[model samples]
Target: MDKATVVRKVILFSALAATVYVSIGTSDEAPVQVKIPTSETIQRPAVSVPGTMQVAEELGAESDGSDPFEPRNWVPAPPPPEPVKEVVAPPPIAPLTIPEGPPALPFQFMGRLKDGTDEVVYLGRGDQPVVARAGEVLESTYKVISITPTQIEFEHLPTKQRQVLSMQSN
Candidate 1:
């Protein structure tokens, strides 16, 4: 064998022999015994305070036969709060009406167009013509609910009233 291989084998054998010698030496010796005296025999007084057992016995006698720790001993829930009387709500009052004539918006419906993708409507507010699709809000208060080729529907935001504009024949 090479000089390096021989040296490595010698080192490995020596380490193994040392480990076996340590294990065998330790096994032959007795383990250290520590005598820590625990207070196992020290008796505790049966009752720490006088008359404590008597008071407990008296209390137990006052209780019903049911175990205090048992679920059955819990006080029955107060008869489910007298079924809250269904309060009859008062009848609804008529909605407030605008004394002024028919509510008018500054804008006027100009025309409507229906493409395969969406239905759009044209509204003329003053000089500007606004194109609105379904669900678009116009002039803040008016919301275009739906638009068709001939007619369009708008919902007044505040009053929730629906108004229809139809195509007028020339």
Candidate 2:
């Protein structure tokens, strides 16, 4: 009807509904000595196996039950190595009789050819001309063109024709 009387009625109705709801929510009876979670002592098993309830005894595990990471129980180890051997070598040797020098320039020193048939050194000092080997000096093939005896003039060695040797310049 009037604005002041309407506002007073709405306030009284809201207060009565609030009291009823709070009383109904707390009406269930719990015991006087109730347990809260933090104040209780929990029960736990001291030793634990990984997957099952029983202990791990099948693989020779000792049940002193210390830290699982410690290596107090492991398999045995192997033995040590053997020593090496040393080698022994042989001694050196000596030779037989001592060897001689190269044979004397492979030549017999034959004397002059036209001196009234004188000795040929290759013919063992006999009558005829003898054949010459490669490095040997022949008397006829090499000539003293003029002789003063201090140094005889020479046209020396290796004649294809007996007159035409002229191997040396001087």
Candidate 3:
């Protein structure tokens, strides 16, 4: 035979021989015999461990239908404390008089302006600014005596006390 025909016949023979070997090797054998014990044949010890028995009793495992894992048997924790009330403090009391010296002036000198021939000075007491010329009375107590570019003079009407405020430069 030629070389190619001889190689094909050898490969076909090898495949057939491998198939037969695997089939025989995998054939079923006799089933194994297993013995199962009956309740009458199986035996348990007459006594259990003392500690295990005590634990089981405490967990209610021996009761007729009680289950230790049930939520109904557990006690709920107390409700959270009531929310605290906010405390409000009272307003402070004002003093009757100054302990020493004259009372402080609330006016702040802003700037000066010239209206006609008379000079006008602006003073801030709180939020509103006051416009004053020479001899203008303010708050029924402070009398404007003179107005200058750098300063303005005032006299307390009741006590005749003179006070001067200089312009604040910015």
lDDT of 3 by residue, 14-94 (tens): 999999988776768765678899999898656555565465676557854554455673678789999999999989888
**How many clashes does each candidate structure show, in the order listed?**
0, 0, 0
Per-residue CA lDDT of model 2 for 53-124, tens digit only, reads 135454457656565555664666556666666766667666687544322222223433333433222322
- lDDT accuracy of residue 142 in candidate 2: 49
Per-model TM-score, in order, reads 0.37, 0.16, 0.39
lDDT of each: 0.74, 0.45, 0.77
User: Which of candidates 1 and 2 is the stronger one according to TM-score?
Assistant: 1
RMSD to the true structure for each prediction, in A, is: 17.5, 23.7, 13.7
Model 3, C-alpha of 98: deviation from truth (Å): 4.8
Best by TM-score: 3
Q: Give the per-residue lDDT of model 1 (tens digit) for 54-160.
A: 54565555544444444663676666566667899999999997664326766677776777797777778889999988888877888988776677788888888
Give, for candidate 2, the lowest lDDT window spanning 10 residues: 160-169
**Which candidate do you rate higher for lDDT, 1 or 2?**
1
Candidate 2 regions exceeding 4 Å error are: 28-170
Residue 80 displacement in candidate 1 (angstroms): 87
